[model samples]
Target: MKLQVTGSISELLTGISHLSEELNFTIGSDGYPISVVKRPGPIEVKNANGQGEICFEKKIHFYRALGLWLQNFEKSKEFHIVEHPQFETSGVMIDASRNAVLTTDGIQMLLRKMAVMGLNLAMLYTEDTYEVPEYPYFGYMRGRYSEIEIKICDDYAEELGIEMIPCIQTLAHLKEALKWNYSNEFRDTESILLAGEPKTYEFLRTIIKSATKPYRSNRIHIGMDEAHELGLGKYLELNGYHNRFEIMNQHLKQVIHITEDLDLKPMIWSDMYFRLASKVGNYYDKDATIPEEIIKMIPNVQMVYWDYYHTEESHYEKMLTMHKLLVDEPIFAGGLWTWNGIAPNYGKAFRTTEAALKANKKFGIKEVFATMWGDNGAETPIQTVLPGMQLYAEYTYHQEVGPEHLAERFEFCTGYHLEDFLLLNHFDETPGVMKDNLYESNPSKFLLWQDILIGLYDKNIEGFPIAQHYEKLIQPLHDAKGKNHDMNLLFHFYEELARVLSVKAELGINLKNAYDQADKDAVHACSEKLSSLRKDVEKLRLAHKKLWFSTNKPFGWEVLDIRYGGLLTRIHSAEERVQEWLDDPTVRIEELEAERLFYNGIYTFGEEGTLGRNLYHRIVSNSVFSD
Candidate 1:
């Protein structure tokens, strides 16, 4: 079908159609391409004289074409898709409830980003970001959205062919409002309700009324996720209330009523709807699933199926099932593919988005939303994923970007864009450094090495299992106890190993300097430094070898199952080993003391001797012990 060429919509689609032959779809006057349900009967294409009902039992080609077209359009020069289209809805939800209230300029920037990605909807979840004078808390940043700011953002979104849907928390994620001392009316209890008193219908009504005043968009998203204390003691105290589901439904229905009164269609997270679905029949003998009850109670209401880990295979299946249930109602599949890092997980996000698109076709899902969650903190640098989001727009709208094209785009998106940003790991700068090595190691020394590398990276090193492998190395050292006569060997082993590592650090700086200098002498100096560092590393290796010789076979046969000891017993073993060393008569007490001090040093001062007390004092203690 040929799109009626008019305004930005025409330009956007025209640029898209130019990129591929399969992007033959047309945007109607209603704002987007009219998605007809694929069936086995006869069909007609507008102006093209094409007629036939296309049966899509498994029309993978057609679905793929649609996804490819989206991907192409995103990469086109006229516009960009800011987020991966398939993973998330073209809908953006901002948590204005938090401290980062939406500034007018920020909202505009978001709109530009969304428009470039072909997004059509936005959900501004606010406690009091925008306020209206009549409503007292509408558009509540300090008071609410001034009529002008609200009009500006809304109109701007409309101009970009996007809709702004205001969101207010009916149940939870309403800390700001509660902090405003307005929670006693809504929160059922203090502990259960963080920012307010207790959850009730009245407070929800006020929030809804306050939030939905400015927007022309009929749709609204009433957030009800993360309500840990769903039913407070007083709520459960109700004579007939047996479960939390009934209480939630009652509050939900009230929200629906409020939305209806405002002539607005309400949308909500499917989480509460799913959680309370089982309890609905038990609570009030009513259909509780939002999709199931759509035609009955709130026919006009839409549901968003949001999954942050959309890259997981299971999540793709879950969304498909959810789409089937919510077929008639507008189901927006929301996916999250970026977090905690500066770069987006392009590979995972792409795969997830592809799955979502495929599912959209399979389960008749019409809308998609890409979500950015502020979980770690606001300083998470979400802007890092903007390029990836744009790539999503491209891939979803258009099928492909060759290596060279993607590389150029990446450079545009990220200042230092490489060719395969999607395939690259986050810390691509450093090589062979794995995470997860710190905790699992038994002796704690090898784990200490992993910790040193992590400090250099200055990033979250929590998930890496590098320490587990280091644990294997620890076993040999631990087993070597009682095999050696010279206790001084162990002391020197650690001290020299540390000194060698320090030399490696110095050599690293010298190598960098040599590269900058680009002179023959500088090159020679770099080579010398590298050679010296290598020798030091060899020395460290020799020290470790000696340590192994002293310890390995002595206690090798005392094999005990660590699991049988439990966590506490395992911890006690380390302390016991230290005690055993202290108690040994043949060992020089001073040398044992010196090693103990070094062990402590390893803990406090990293492998590089950064952050520790004076080494002089520790040596003095050793000398005193020896004398």
Candidate 2:
């Protein structure tokens, strides 16, 4: 693995060496001479005099070449390097606003991984996760990054040849910030900014200025998506009647002016414009059309068509084609599926990202990136999605990359087998079910957190055989416990979670049946199981705490504590109710016998507003014993 390099390639080798110690290289003229050549497309590598000579057109291409060499050497495969990047910018976006602000060390670890995978852009998707000098309550108590920390991150990324871009919400998704008294003057609704207010423009300018000040890249992402109720709230109360498009157009003009003044290029989610223009309220409607007048009103801001749901290549093809009709150059932001629950959905992410990348290549879309959103308290760690990230890198350069090649590259880059890492997705997959699409709705999460007395997901999971699935995962998880220390705790956490879910999933149904039969023996058995399950849940809590603190900041662990602690308290109450019911057969368990329960065809649990609905989507009501 010794090699001699010159010019930009030598610089690339130095950077790669800093990231990975597994790579061996020596500055000698004998073994391998890696050269840089100004080629039009794809890198060229030739073997001469028993030495490997690699040539590339750009520094990023050289990094990809080095990645190929490392993969070949590690896997004991032949050296074959021919890659050209599909997009000019390909990277990962870490959502910092969703309560899991990555520590500086975490950022460095990810940057190192990104460098090894030949990703050239990195975006910290900050909604309110950076220090704004004038706004004290902005990102307050949220572990936001300071200016010094941002500089360190930027410098480190620059050394690795990554363009660290700033992605901040300029319009909507500012619910956390809007909670402050100062933000009351600018709030139009719960989440969006006031469109035509003078104070709103001032707030936008300050936010844009503060966000762009830390990063070196002039490219900024002003997230303007999902502002559905844009001008219908307070703006409606004040301004009588006005066109929604007019409101958004004026708002965009004001925001773009601030970006221009700051010498920054701003990008926005194109969904809002599409949703507002189309007759149907769908963002991904294939035949959705935007009014030409409305399209003309938009400024020179880049449109980012963020699509993470569709799995078909034709869906992306139509979407990208529609996006191209709107703007000359549009960026495509795909999802890595890290926000699903406590684990990464690698299976769904892989298929969706592969299809999206192929569509991007076909449509000649230049810039592309995968978003790792931390929705719902950012429970899932970003490291769990390393396989998906590596896949993005693989598909960016090589169009025909197969799963085997991806797995090998993943091992070479991250020091873990792809199969071992993909076990994270197995917990979500229902056994013997072909198309068990969770659609970002994780059953394991709901089952683990569902009330034991109510058993919302209990009868719902009739044929899942979740207990057997969890039993099978225990040994494999124990085997992978030593692969990555940070991830070891995660594996152990899932194992504990599976153990708890196995019992919790069936406890409610079994307990209710025993109660209806008025069998003392069955009641006693259910009581014993409940007590043991409580102990197991307590152990899972401890493991969850350890796993949370191991890779994430301490700020967001409170959410886990709340959920787990709440479940623990409910279990104690469930035990009391069971004892009461057994002692005197007259005690009423209203939750177990609610009359107005409606079972949607899909969910055996109740519908959206029902007591047995999904835990992640709806808040668990206050305890029945509280009154």
Candidate 3:
């Protein structure tokens, strides 16, 4: 396909031209023609004679118009489609601070997808994963992006007509950056900065300047949320328990002054303000009240209200209403649900997006974006969140769209099947799982990483056929690799995940049951199965490692490597313990006698019952691990 461009839309041709190679389309005189036009209205596409005319209101709208045109290109003889975008600034915020920092190439790849989806905003959530010229240990051993890398990504986003804003932290969420010995002077606690300290403002200024230098956007997201230890650490020792609200407000004024000096607009997470107002310090407190003086003293910075877990529209509506009390118009940030576990939770993501975006529309909020946060090691492949992104894109333009329309648009934007991308969810959404999966249940992750000997989640899954569920998904995921072509790496990882879970899911249950029954033969079989499972674990680790390296920087893979090695060592331990028990019946297996309990403490093991956990440390043991 060939694109004829004019005015501002011409820059996007370079950004989207690569699609010619990826989508296997030839750009020639005889190829399909798309005339790009820019104006100030809804995205309008019309086909007449032999060429397609794509008229868009914004630069971001052009890419979306092109996608819509392509979706109906050859199928229809002649047609017209008009899509009106709801939000002014809508896109994604990739969590680069988590273990996985996307490579520059991967960021460019995603920009294309964002352009296709008609999203105009892009943010890289880098707490410490961006280079600070003066601080060498800011992102030590973390694959932090250099100035050149950030510049390249921002340039690519510009070509795609997307606003790439630098999302950095000026207050808390800097545990990785602050743990080094050099940070002792300014650090109040592990994660929070010493807000009252004189040097803290200087440090904040340096980081804020460094973070914004590579981007063209005048906007910066200054993360000031979840700073629970604001005055509880060294600040308490120095100031003798100062009021947290006063401390926070003073810190905000200092940070805002820096941003103002740099000629930039700043946005802060609204959680801290709401938390201080709440009776119990909850961000979503419905009855939370702010003192009249405090309300009058609120700064002019943008208040970003982020909600990811809500499955109900009423909760978003209620939260949005509360946010307005803080700021006249608040920017809404929803979650893409990629942070859950090894696989993306499409069910939870779709439910939350629909519910939240609808609330955003009803409230007349103009700005929105979904966050792809990588909590707990960031194991899930980022590309698996495509269908969820598509869902957000559809909701951005239409009040409502049918399943068939979403699927068709998805296939057009991404040359892959929606069902195949969705099949990745089967790892966790197995037989015992609920229809909506509202509880954030992630059995696949806990099952694979849990101590098989102790069997933490074994009792919860004793009666359910979870292993059989994984077995059923093995072949489909394995076969999907060839169908997806470029996505073979992701599917191969998924296939290996299914392979590992098929055996590992019920290994502890079978072994413990056999030990209780005094069935020496069944116990022996379980031991042999552990040996084979070790090989499968190794395969899964290699598959995941390969996939990670292909998309992300090599720095983060070490964290996951440690996790894989731990599971392998525990499996070997299980084998040795089982062998010792088989040889000497007199020496009893202490762990096998231990009783299993429900994962959520007291929930029944049936409908709507779920672990709702995604943290690996919690799944593996009750002891203290990573904090």
Winner by TM-score: 3
Would you list the C-alpha lDDT of every candidate in the order shown?
A: 0.43, 0.77, 0.86
Instruction: Report the lDDT tens digits of candidate 3 across residue range 456-560.
Output: 888777789999999999999988998876899999999999989999999999999999998999999999999999999999999999999998999989989
Model 2 scores worst on lDDT over the 10 consecutive residues at 604-613
lDDT string for model 1 (40-60, tens) is 422111211221111121122
lDDT of 1 at 174: 54
TM-score pick, better of 1 and 3: 3
Winner by lDDT between candidate 2 and candidate 1 = 2
Candidate 2 has a TM-score of 0.92
Could you report the Cα RMSD, in angstroms, for every candidate shown?
Answer: 18.8, 3.3, 2.0
Candidate 1 achieves a global lDDT of 0.43
- In model 3, how large is the Cα lDDT of residue 166? 93
lDDT of 2 at 606: 42
Q: lDDT at 417 for candidate 1?
A: 40
Candidate 2 stretches with Cα past 4 Å from truth are 1-10, 22-41, 45-50, 75-78, 432-438, 484-486, 583-588, 593-619, 622-627
Pitting candidate 2 against candidate 3, the one with the higher TM-score is 3
How many clashes does each candidate structure show, in the order listed?
74, 0, 0
lDDT of 2 by residue, 426-493 (tens): 76665532342425446666677777776645555655576677767777887787875446877788
